[model samples]
Target: MASPLSALLLLALLALPAARDAAQDRVDDGGGYEDEEGEAVEEGEGVLPSPGQRQGSCPSSCTCSPDGAVECAGAGLDSFPASLPADTQLLSLQNNQIEVVPIAALKRVPLLRTLNLQNNLITSAGLPADGFMVLKELQYLYLANNKLTQTPGSLPASLVSADLAANFLTAISPGTFGGKPDLRSVYLHNNRLTNAGIPRDAFLGSDAVETLILSSNSLTRAPLGLPPALQRLHLRNNKLHSLSGGAFDQLRDLRELYLQHNQLNDRSVDAKTFTHSRRLEYLDLSSNNLTLVPRGLPARLVILHLERNAIAALDSQGLGRLRSLEYLLVHSNRVRAHAVGAAAFRNLRRLHTLHLYSNELNRVPRSLPAHIKVLMLLHNTIHEIRAQDFAATPELAELNLSFNRLSTKRLHPRAFTRLSKLASLDLTGNQLTHVPVGLPASLEVLRIQQNHVAVLGNGALSGLPALRELMLSDNALASKTIAPNIWAQLPSLTTLDLSSNALTVVPSSLPASLEYLYLQNNRINSIPEGAFSTTPNIKGIFLRYNRLPPHVKDMFMGLEELQVLDLTGNFDGTPEPGADDGEGGDGEGGDGDEEEGMGNPQKELPQRRRAVERGTSVPRPQKT
Candidate 1:
């Protein structure tokens, strides 16, 4: 299509009688490319998977290139692979098991473009101060999924696309990408970056960037004064506390924008904050701490993420201005779930995904758009969910209504009667003692964690013909309570979470697709011989935080490929087995079984948590 489009193109087919000549060339050494045993990144694609793909092979730590790039990605490289000769154009080392990338290793390839090392283990690129000078012709560098501590590389003059997501990097040097005038596509999501340390001039001169993603960082201020060519900006999951109205006034041509999961307190985003982004099409501001929505954005805004905030109610006067806005997310805020204004997003005719989970909603409000596909309202104070509430959105596919204050009053028997294409429904975290009847037959994932479900009765899952994941954890379904035919009913069930219940024995009734089973924090004292006799494909199990009797002889059974078993916080005064099971008694007494699974138990976070009801939630539903 165009310059950048040509760079992202992949897979070209050879045609006609020239095929014979191409085959002849393949027979010779100078022949185009040798048929390697494994598949490599198809040339010219925007991204590429690593050797561990279904195609497999190459050393676990090695980076393999198919575009005649031996020096660029060969040998068991634990670091960033060295560069190759000028002939090498595109280089991809994605999904490799690499650990670290030594900065000096990349200087050898001066003409390299499109360097993709995503999903690799390299922590920090550690580029030398002169790295920009050494790889002058390099472009498109992807460094996602690593343990980086800081930005280790600077931008080259010709560099364009860049991705540094999911790293430990804490800051962005201001002058890093100063003068790259034609640079485009910058992705830095899921990092530990901050604003004070960032050079104010980091993006001073790049005038051609179309997309800039800096989500999941620790930024405090909005990086304003961007080039006129900027289009998309992603800054979700940051630590931003406030922003002056003129923060993003420079980007007049901006389109898509994401700013969710940040500390967007009362003073952060004013109505005029995005006044310069008039052409915006997508906007996400969910999971922030905003108390009110100040006015002053474009009427053409689309795709809003305002979930998990402190907004108690909507000031209709403010949200009514956006006539073209679509996909509004106001879930998990201080607003009463039933207090939503009918016209909140009535102008959004193209809305698709709506998230309103973990709020004070007692029931679904009326006047919902009919085109919604994904609706989330789980973990709230909602007392009931009437099927008629969703009649407006007939095209709905998935619905989440887990962890609420609702009691045994079941949802509308025909709750999904109008949802012809409904696929998934979650009704966890409530006072229900059984499965609801309104779930659609086309459902796939049903998460009913942390409820009073003591058994699976008649209408538990009557219409679900294609359910896959069933989360019945934190309930009272002891060994004999879960109907044998309950799990057997869903042929596609794969993940079953029954942890934190009163189950005393594991049931043999399980589906063939079952892969993960979580049975931790329960009264289960032992595993019977045929606990998993039927589920041969099971892979992982969590037996941590339980009381297993000492007299029991065997543990997990029939799980041939079972990868992990969390036995922490469980004890019967067993001796050390010298394994990393983390088992030991609650006290540091000689009992070793209780310590097995607690070795590396993830520490609790300070964020507001959804409190699953005890006998309904795992970990005994400690109050949040």
Candidate 2:
């Protein structure tokens, strides 16, 4: 592997001079197409034939000049063969192992406009300013991932877009990008810009500069006084602890602002921080220590990212003001109980995505907007979900309630009764003793990994016929979870995640549409006899970290169609009963079926059925 490229092994005829000389000798000996000067005629410049053209004495080197265009990528060459193509407009050296860019080599092609040196080993120490200055026609320069310091050695005046990410440049003076006046986009992220003050000229001279990415730098303040045309700016993962109130005031046309992963406290931001940027739509201030926000933010903000903050809580008053907010991501915050109301989201009519994961709440909030489509509630302290908790969320399509403190006693029968359009449901990482039912009929993805679920009584997901992905790994269930007729119940399930559980057996009749099946880390001496019954469409399977028995036939059976299968962490043999597939049938059946729909509904069934199944199953009181 080369220094800049850990990929793509190919060889190019780097010794173009030798090859060309030898071919010329051969052509001269044959007296091929001799001109009046008695010199053997050879194809020159753009007159060179393709691989299928004139056979004798073809030039080994191909170059593009400032006016001509040349692209020799993926031609099975490891290095840049030589020879200058004059007046080239564009030259691409993509996906090659050319250890060193012939900077002087490019000088021969003075008319070059666009030079793409991406995925190469052109280093900074070898970068000569003279190698780049000759190409006076250069406009776009893509020099990504090539151990370079300051790219291009210099920016040409006509250049428009410059991509220099994933490099090791520690210093960029206003002089570094001095020439480009028509520049529109500049990418300079993932570099060693430590404790450095960005030059005032960092964004100077660019009358058309619109987007700039200076991420992963060491800056304590927002770069103030940006051009008015600046629209998109990315400054994530920087030491921006202080943001001036007018840091972003000059950019009247700014739209998307990404300032995540900074150390800015609440006082660092102000309402007037975005006073004139009325057209702004997306604002990402995630992973910051902002506890207080100034009133009257941009009213028409389409996305607001306040995640991983110390906002403490969100009562009806504070959140009610953002009338036009669409996506509110405040996850990983200290927001706790009594602060969030069901109606708190009712005012945000345009709100569609709400991410409140990792909070300190024991119960679900009420009056959440029914119009919200994506709701993420994972990694919280929620232990109970009342009937009206999610009553108004009718349009919810994706819901993630994983990593909580939920249990069988907390699942309300009508909890999801109103979410008819719900699609993706995540209940992973919790204390659930069973798979609660009456899931939205339109759910497509369900993630319930890492729970205390003990059994799949039956019809656990009968309502979610449209479900495509079901993740239920790391639980107390055993072979009982894997029903051979699993597909018969949920025919639409496409992805199943069942890793880190007490699975001594695998479900044989899983849906054939399953593309991803995760079943790692559990106690199982032998593979289930019904593992993957006719489900050849499975593309991947994870069995790592489990005590899987060495039964070759059962282990790899029906796995030819599987593209991935892991058998990691299988230590012992055990059996648990959480795979309840409503042997009692769909929700139409009274108490027996309710056992799989909602935990409490089963208790409402007549005592006669409980008496009959009491010997076979534990019949808890249903609280319908």
Top lDDT: which candidate number?
A: 2
Total backbone collisions, model 1: 33
Q: What digit string (tens of lDDT, one per residue) describes model 2 on residues 53-158?
A: 2222212444322224465655444545556444445566755655565554665556556677655665665455545655566766776556666554465677
Badly placed stretches (over 4 Å) of model 2 are 1-67, 70-83, 92-107, 117-134, 143-155, 164-181, 191-204, 294-296, 315-321, 341-344, 445-447, 458-464, 467-624
Candidate 2 positional error at 339, Å: 3.0
Residue 413: error of model 1 in Å? Answer: 3.6
lDDT of 2 at 5: 16
Task: Tell me the whole-model lDDT of each prediction, alpha carbons only.
Answer: 0.61, 0.63
Candidate 1: residue 176 Cα off by (Å): 8.7
Error of 1 at 305 (Å): 3.0
Q: What tens-digit string does per-residue lDDT give for candidate 1 at 1-624?
A: 444324332311112113323332332222221111111111111123232232222334433354423222333444544333333445556555566444444544445565666555554433344444555667666665555566654677787766665667677765566678768876666567777656667777788888776765678777755566778776766667776757677787888877766677766767677777789877776677776665776788776667767877664566777767656778768777456777766766777877777667777767776788888877677776676888788888887776677776656667667777888877777788777766667778877787888887645766666888888888888877766667677788878888888887765667778888888878887776676777778766676667875333234432445545555555564532422222333311242232232321121100001111111222210222
Q: What lDDT is obtained when candidate 1 is compared to the true structure?
A: 0.61
Residue 336 lDDT, candidate 1, scale 0-100:
74
